[model samples]
Target: NAGIAATMPALDYPLAHWQLTMAVNVTAPFLIAQHTLRAMRRKQWGRIVNVASISGVRAGTGRLGYGTSKAALIALTRQFAIEAAEWGVTVNAIAPGPVDTPLIRGMHGGSTAGTYASMLPMRRYGTTAEIAHAVSFLASEQAGYITGHSLAVDGGFLASGLLVRDLFEPAASAPS
Candidate 1:
């Protein structure tokens, strides 16, 4: 989903922006699956991959519409997975973190880029190819057993917490 950022306080957030974002990020997936599922069901095999976002799992400072919409996409992936699994269809989602894409560059250019890097344990943004690799793996025959999973290609950002204690630790206490 190519979502537009409408960052604002809840009271100030535009309803149009929220609706538009949800339409693209959430509703489109449902529509696509609705149209495509019948063919896959006939074939008895299908791969439905939804590209969600970390914002969906963890709400950010000013991403009400984008986050909420992506959360819905993730939920949709699960619902579709349950209903489609018997037909040999695997529905999954990829929740990408800060990636070195035009979108990220546009959103976090200049010194602000470092702020996003610091939040992740990897201390860097992910690459588009890395995300593609994950998707490729999920789509592969070897991944047939995997379904309804939201894979985080986020360089550990989603699983990690702030390292406040690490900052105050002596050099010796730091992991090598």
Candidate 2:
């Protein structure tokens, strides 16, 4: 569970940023799994919970690199789950929405938080503890049957369709 919110328009996006995002968000997890799976396979029981983001499940402004990497991370989780299931290992992801973290505060503008709160069904950001609870559940023995799943810890962000009244407005429109 690693990531970098590299926000940039498609045209202005840099290859370096893309590579770095992939390296941290995707490749790092892949490598960690590669190194650890063998041991878990030997034990016939293990849990691997990855940290994904709502950005992966739903597109957003200036999230080209971040979103793409997270999407890849989700796919990678599925692939690993399929192979590791027989070994009693679970590979899952936790896609958190806007959580109250330093990283998020740094990424979001002054009004961005208020706008997101308005859009979310819960009308608030999630806490790190909430996300941790989800991860803990997936890692526990009770969740042995669950694998290859990207659980949304979002505050109904993924389930949302329309929240704003002015659908015609560009700001209220869906992300391009």
lDDT of each: 0.83, 0.86
lDDT of 1 at 166: 34
Model 1 misplaced regions, further than 4 Å: 162-176
Candidate 2 TM-score, C-alpha based = 0.91
lDDT of 2 by residue, 119-152 (tens): 8899999999999999999999999999999999
Tens digits of lDDT, candidate 1, 42-150: 9999998889988788777567888899899899999999999999999999998888988778867686678668867899999999999988988888889889999
**RMSD of every prediction:** 5.4, 3.9
